[model samples]
Target: MFTTIHRWGNSQAVRLPKGILETASLRENDRVEITAEYDRIIIRKATKKHLTIEERFEGYNGDYRCKEADTGGPVGNEEW
Candidate 1:
């Protein structure tokens, strides 16, 4: 899709087409995650973050591999 950047209050904003907005299911005031990867920029829905380990494993099942010594422990030290 193509769009021209227009002024929005103080910062400039791009007008997204209805199709694009629908496809992304974005609504006004909704949060969208933005990040730069390699030569491209990516935008997607923002995910909820769990602060405590218990919060992170709230609904986890065998879908995760926990340390044998620590059943509630994360499989790896990687960030969720």
Candidate 2:
């Protein structure tokens, strides 16, 4: 398919058809990495790095203390 590049808010944008997006397994608002190689423009889905629990909290002082909150008696049939 042929598409024309148009000016969009000071940026050049090209509209990708739904078929192309579906084939690429991409959805609206999905992040993509665009690169220019020679005379070709490559568009690929961005990969996200999943961090582990320890990696998420690398720097922690552990100075936090939990305090019980006084929530008024339950209004429903719940065991305390």
Candidate 3:
């Protein structure tokens, strides 16, 4: 449960254990929010910006028509 902080290029980094990362639900390249609370360092998973249904459909501007054409309006007694 102990690790030594080392310098990575220009910044210092601490290698987290796989168990700790799994417990925290973290993965490689995942973003984290780091903050200093008085004397303690808090590291939390950053909230992902997920697009809603409306937002996903925002780019669509035209009506999507099917390939099949209507069969000349209903002629038989098709029960409205």
Candidate 4:
């Protein structure tokens, strides 16, 4: 399979075929890491890091209070 590199605005872009994407388990809007090694370009899916709840709120001072907000009443067919 072959593809042509086209000028997209200010950068060069290559359109990967559907088969290639499927083989790599890649989807549209997926994050990828691109690197150039010698004369070849490599593309790989970016790994996501999962943070625990404690890690996510490492610097919190616990000063938040939950409040009920008035939504101007229900408009359509609400059982409330």
Q: After superposition, how far is residue 68 of candidate 1 from its true place, in Å?
A: 35
Return the candidate ranking by TM-score, descending.
4, 2, 3, 1
Colliding residue pairs in candidate 1: none
lDDT for position 59 in model 1: 85
Model 2: per-residue Cα lDDT over 1-80, one tens digit each: 99999999989999999999999999999888899999999999989656799988888778889999998888778767
Q: What tens digits encode model 4's per-residue C-alpha lDDT throughout 1-80?
A: 98999999999999999999999999999888899999999999989666799999999998999999887877889758
Indicate the residue-level lDDT of 58 in model 1: 79
Off by over 4 Å in 1: 49-80
Please give the CA lDDT of all the candidate structures: 0.76, 0.92, 0.88, 0.93
The alpha-carbon lDDT assigned to residue 66 of candidate 2 equals 92
Q: Model 2, which residues run further than 4 Å from truth?
A: 49-80
lDDT, residue 6, candidate 4: 100
Output the better candidate (2/3) by TM-score: 2
List per-candidate RMSD values in Å: 11.3, 14.9, 15.4, 14.0
TM per candidate comes to: 0.48, 0.62, 0.57, 0.62
Model 1 C-alpha RMSD to native? 11.3
The Cα error of candidate 1 at residue 25, in Å, is 1.9
Candidate that beats the other on TM-score, 1 or 4, i.e. the better one? 4
Tally clashes: model 1. Answer: 0
Q: Candidate 4, which segments miss by more than 4 Å at Cα? A: 49-80
Top-scoring candidate (lDDT): 4
Inter-residue clash pairs, candidate 3: none
Ranked by lDDT, the better of candidates 1 and 4 is 4
lDDT of 4 at 27: 99
